[model samples]
Target: MKPLERLGEAKTPDGTVLQLYRHDGAYLIRADGVELMSTRRHLSEDKLAEVACAPLVTKPKARVLIGGLGLGFTLREALRHLGPDAEVVVAELVAEVIQWNANPEYALSAEAMADPRVRIVHEDVSKVLRNNVGGFHAIMLDTDNGPEGMIMKENSRLYATRGIAATMAALKPEGTIAYWSVGDDPGFVRALENAGLEVKAMKVRAHATSGPFHTLYIAS
Candidate 1:
């Protein structure tokens, strides 16, 4: 069997190490020795985009914001769902992650990044949400490991009440937001409901047929 090779790494705002790895044909990213995401199992990520952008498939000139760019699966799935006239703004905090996807040797997201309708922003998603009031027809948040902060300490705020509020404000009146979580986070659901959003928690597999169940929270 081939051994896993460390490709590259970067540091988070809290000084946590984010490492990228490859084994066989799969890519994996770890935060402080914990698995953050992998190309081998990204059905949940694809679902996050499908649920968030499905409503806007026919909406002309629709705009959407994606909070993370894990292997660009969500972005690719979103581009597949939205119309050609729609625009997708991806806000990724870690520059290395973006770089890894752009590097042809890694073969990650270079094609998705080249999409004319897609715009890449190298900034924290929280700040993006704060600045874009009613700016997106849909919002997708797949940062950190669910509502908990695994990659960066500051990412927790993206799931907090304040962060949820910012997402609400950033969305158009009929817009929807989807959150990807590694597990069920009941408390986070309460916070979304408290914000007056009708929440739908969908259990999705990490892989298409089988894998640990991940939660996809759709709120509007």
Candidate 2:
């Protein structure tokens, strides 16, 4: 068994304590002693920023918004697929989690922070989506374990009907919104449908280098 090491800490808007840890070369975030993400060599544990882009972000001027910054895995993987003209904006609620990437001691796994095309915003993703930045090419959300939402009480709203609508409004007509889940979620898909999005879920296996086995909700 791989040992657990404390990496950092994060607190939600409502003041829930989240502890970051590492195991077997993977990173995990926990809240009230519950394991949030047990990272592997793959990005599915932090999907949206990495795996979700496989189908949608092909253009040279793709503007992407990544929700969550877990270990920087998804952000780094995202950079690999984007062109020089691409721009990635990450929305992270916790400032410390962002620091983990910039902090010299933590060894930023994704290094997305250092990238010239990346922008980190310290705020709730839900509020930013309300900003309706307009004309975003893709929006990938890996904010919680899944639609079930345990890390933060308000996180479930992201999967709610209104939230889905807001996300759709924030995107261009041809834009894609990809959601990451720890497991399968059907209700969230229904919300996407209610928002008038053409939705497709791609099931991806949780692992390293295994391709497209995880379910990605591609709503356009």
Candidate 3:
């Protein structure tokens, strides 16, 4: 087996340590000392886009906002599901995460990033959500480990009442927003409802049909 290689490191806006590592030909990202995401287990990430865009796939000129580039699995999946005229805007907090996906040696999301329909923005996703009003047909968020397990302390706001309200305003009428979490968060679900969006919680496996399960909060 190949030993894990440290690809690079970056700091979040709040100065939290974010590191990238490669092991067994797969990539992983860690915040502080906790493993945040890995290339080997991205099925749920793909599902995030698929489930959110299912209703909008036939809509003409559908537009989607993806929070957190991660390895671009969600972005790539969104591109595949939407039509050629569709647009995908990805807001990544850390620029290094975007660079890692563009790295050819990694072959993670190089092609996805180059797609004409896709746009990359180096900014906090919460700001993107707050600034846009009815701009997107769908929004997918996987920026942190739910509302409670925040990699960056500031991210807590995104899952709070005000943040949920901001996201609700950013979406078109009946637009869907899907949030990926490492575990179930009932309080966040209630917050989404209080924000005036219907919500459903789903349990998705970390790897297709195996591994631990993760929660997905789909709201509209």
lDDT of each: 0.92, 0.75, 0.89
> How many Å off is the CA of 66 in candidate 2?
0.5
For candidate 1, list the clashing residue pairs, or say none: none
What lDDT, from 0 to 1, does candidate 1 have? 0.92
TM for every model, in the order presented, reads 0.97, 0.87, 0.97
- Tell me the tens digit of each residue's lDDT in model 3 across 1-220: 6898999999987999999999988889999979998889988898999899877778899999999999889999999899889999999988899899998888599999999999999999988988888999999999878787787887888888888888889999878899999888788877888887888898888898678898999997
lDDT of 2 by residue, 1-220 (tens): 6778887777787888888886665566787788665555345645566555665456777788888876677788788878888888888888888877777666565455878989899988888888856757788888867687557786888888777878887786577888887666787777778768888877767675664355677778
Question: Any idea what lDDT model 3 has?
Answer: 0.89
What lDDT does candidate 2 reach at residue 215? 64
Tell me the tens digit of each residue's lDDT in model 1 across 1-220. Answer: 9999999989988898999999999999999899988999999999999988887899999999999887899999999999999999999999999999988888699988999999999999999999999999999999888885355787898888899999999999899999999898899999999999999999999998888999999999
The candidate with the higher lDDT, 2 or 3, is 3
> How do the candidates rank by lDDT, highest first?
1, 3, 2
Estimate the overall C-alpha local distance difference test score of candidate 2: 0.75
